[model samples]
Target: MDITIEDKFHASCFTLKKEDILKFDKEDNGPINNVLIGIEHHCYGVRFFDDRHGLSVEMFYINGKGLLKGDIIQLQVRDPQYYQLLLRFCVLLADDYKEVNALIAFNTFQNKLRGFLEKRGIFTVTSLELRQFKGQSAVMVSPSPRGIVKIDFINQKEFYVDFFNKIANKPIEKGKEHVYLMVNNDTGLIKIGRSNNPVYRERTLHSKEPSVHRIAMWCCEQNIEKKLHIIFKDKRIRGEWFRLSLADLIEIEKFMDSV
Candidate 1:
């Protein structure tokens, strides 16, 4: 089988014999599978099959023009383990194309990729949703292992900083306190408070009420406790405590998005 991969940089042709395809199939204990390859062009297709029954063939089409401006290479693998293997294969084949390796790394291991990008002053925002609130555009960034974070800043760098701060669990700076929403594990009650020292505050709350746990915290400049108190006045069970409800939680999220 002959395979050709053409990109903006160069054109290369690769040939795989019937024995080689059989070897791979035998090792994986599966028939030749189809894998999707994507780059700048839309018509490219890649396929694999056995040749003994007049079916053995592996073909990939690559445009000779190479990568142009705004070109991104994408690969889709259905199997998780195969995804990793294909990524490694791509890295080897596209050894000179740094962007190809980067795209694979980002899609395969997003958390690790984000960490790497952040160290080098590059950031990616995923699951971003924009909403119109109070006649203003509100941007909501949903980072994994954390709740949605809303910020009013339009600057990309500042937005990345705010998003990173939340995901990293870094301490809130003085005068840049956070409005935390916690829940009592035993009683299922919600607690809202402001704190610059969240760790200490969480410890203190646990000491006072051993069954309480910090659920989520939002970084905000203003005193959010006051506004939250007024909004959930009816649901308030006691000082800084409210009866947790689905409606109240949705309202809380909306409030966060607005700020």
Candidate 2:
């Protein structure tokens, strides 16, 4: 199956297929180009090409680690406008598929693409966003409508405040601090921390530890990390590290909702 989005200026299309998905395990031929793994959704494979006209993206499902056996969709966007709408559509699709929890980017453009998604109420995790190619870091995102709405209202009051903050390297407001929970999907270990700039923090953490995989962050006004640490003191394996438990995860989600 295929879906296309076009306007007078450009055209974009997506193709879906039911085929053997690529595995990134050690046995496979070098990793698929620009692979993005989603905990809830399947995985994505992205490729970029440019010519005299402009830039284009070829996106597809690279693996089925978490999804049921069915048709996987591949997307192609020709330019910026098409790319933007296509990504919004992708988020809608992701919302429908619980398995998709992250979007993968291979190149600079895709990194920016994921950033755009992040601004639209979709949050990202550091562990799930991987950069196969040695270049700039990839932006890994998860959906958080509350966070998105908050950011949207902030941007409206002060246009591009988020974007400028990143570029200008401004300090994140102490009052706007967010407490984040990072989970290692492979080992099932969790880390609790706080940051005003979660994305930058994720990039730094990814650079320091390649093993970290899935992350969940929630914004709060209070110092919740210390409180959480005390609450899970018995389960603490080390500094800010704890054994995985459903109770803790549930509590964390509930805290996010309250704050």
Task: Give candidate 1's error at residue 142 in angstroms.
Answer: 41
Candidate 1 C-alpha lDDT tens digits along 98-192? 22322223233434333433443333444322333545766544444333222111222222235334432555566668888766654556788
Give the alpha carbon lDDT tens digit for every residue of 85-123 in model 2: 544444433444433322212222355445544544445
lDDT of each: 0.46, 0.47
- Per-candidate TM-score against the hidden true structure: 0.35, 0.33
How much is the lDDT of residue 59 in candidate 2? 51
Task: Report lDDT (Cα) of residue 55, candidate 1.
Answer: 21
Question: Model 1 has how many clashing residue pairs?
Answer: 6
